[model samples]
Target: MKKQLLVAVSLCAGFIASAMADSRVTIHYPGQSQALVLQGAANLEQLTLRPELNGRTWWPGTVIAERTASGIQQQTQQQTQQQLLARLSAFSAALRGDNDGELAGSVDRVRTQLAAMRVTGRQFVPLDPDWIRLHAEANRRLSGEYSVYTLSRPTSVQVVGVTTPAGPQPYQPGRDVAEYLQTHQRLSGAEKNVVWVIQPDGKTEKVPVAYWNHRHVEVAPGSIIYVGFSSWSLPRAYRDVNEQIVSLLTHRIPD
Candidate 1:
C-alpha cells in the first residue's frame, strides 16, 4: 500500500511541474536564417538579456507576437478595415465622382496596401532594458508562444494617403517633414495645412506643412507621412476617418 501511495504522489508532482513550466519563445533576428528558441524566460527583462541579443543595433519598433492574442487582434483589424472601406465608399458617393476620382483612387491604393499586410498580435514595445525596467507594464511576465522580432534599421520613409503613386520615398537625414511632402504630389482632396507622421515606434503626430503654419518637424527614417483627406471635405458622419486611418497604420508590420 505504501509503494502505491508513493507512485501516486510522484505522478501528482510531475503533473504540477509540467503545468508550471514556461512556454517556448522564438527570437528572430534580421538576416538570420534560423531563429533562436528560448525556454524558461520569465519576462521581457530576462528575454532581452539573452546573449543572442547582444551587440545588435536594436530597432526601437521591435515586435512581440503573442500566440494567445493573435485571434482577437486579427478580428479587431478586420473590423476596422471594413469600417474604413465603408466610410471611404460613402465619401466617394458624396463627391459624385468629382475631382477626377483622384481622392478615391489614392485612398483605395492605401487600403489595398494595408489589406495585404498580415494582422498579428504584434505589440510595439520598446525592447530597451532600461525602458522595460522603468515601466512595470513593459516588464510583465511572458507566457505562450511569443515571437520576438529584432528588425534592421530601415532606410526609407513611406508616404501614403492622398498622394499619387503612394509608396516609399528616400529618407534624407535632417530633412523637414514639409520637404518630404513637397516631393510627393498631394492628390485632390488631400489635407494641405497639416500632415500626420507615424513614426516607427508607433507614435503619431500631426505636423503643419502649410506656409503660414509650417513647423520644422524632422521626418525620421522608417516613418510614414500620411497626407489624409481634408477635414472640410469629409462628410459629417465620417469626419473622423482620417484619425481612424492613422490608428490603423500604427498596427502595420514593418517590412
Candidate 2:
C-alpha cells in the first residue's frame, strides 16, 4: 500500500512539473501589453512574433517581430507593428464608442510620440521590414546573443532650428545641439566647420553632431526637433525603454 501511495505522489509531482514547463512566457510593459508567447521552436510559422508571442495571446491574426535570443529589437519591431494594427482597429471601433483595452493604450502612446514630433501633420510612417530586421539584429547584439554588429556606416545628421531649414546640415558637436560633444577640442561653435558631420550611410554630410538620422521637424518657431532621428518607439515588451530606444535608433536605419 505504501508503494502505491508513493507512486501516486510521484505522478502528481510530475504533472505539476510539466504544467509549469508548459506555461507561456509572459511579457508586459505597463501601458504596453501583457501576453504570452508560447514556448516552442523559434522557427514557428503561424506567428510573426518571436517564439514567445506566437499563440500566447488572443490576437486577431498573425503579429510581427519574432523574438530571438538576440536583442530587444525584435520587441521594438513588434511594438511598431502592433501599434499600427491597434490604431487601425481603434479608429474603426470608435464608430461604436468602443475601445479595446490592449490596443487603446498602444495607440495612445503612438499618438503622444507623434504629437511630440515637429512634423505633427506627418502621419506615422508605416513600419518597415528592414527596420524590423535591423532591430532584431541590434537586439541580438545588445542582449549578448551576438558578439557585435557591423554598422553599414553613419549617413547624415541634418540639423534644424526654431525657424530655419538648417538644410540637411552636418552634425555639429557644440552648435545647434550639444548631444554629441566629444573629447576632441579642435572644433568650436563659432566655426561653421565645427557642425559638419559624416553619417553612417557612407554619405558625407554636415551637422552639429552625429545626430542619428536625417529626418526631423521644428517645434514651433524657436523650438526644434532634432533631425536624423528615429521615431522613439516604446518597447511594448518588458525591457528597458531608453536602452531599447537608443539601440533601435542608433542601429543602422533600415534600408
Among all candidates shown, the one with the greatest TM-score: 1
C-alpha lDDT of residue 132 in model 2: 44
* Model 2 Cα lDDT, one tens digit per residue, 27-113: 432134344334422222212344334333322111123234653545555455444445434543552355344333343433344
Per-residue lDDT value at 85 in model 2:
43
Residue 253 displacement in candidate 1 (angstroms): 0.7
Off by over 4 Å in 1: 1-21, 28-37, 52-57, 93-100, 133-137
TM-score, predicted candidate 2 vs. hidden true structure: 0.22
Candidate 1, clashing residue pairs? none
TM-score of each: 0.79, 0.22
Tens digit of lDDT per residue, candidate 1, span 71-111? 56556766877777777766665555665466666566666
Alpha-carbon error at 207 in model 1, in Å? Answer: 0.8
Q: What are the lDDT figures for the candidates, one per model?
A: 0.76, 0.31
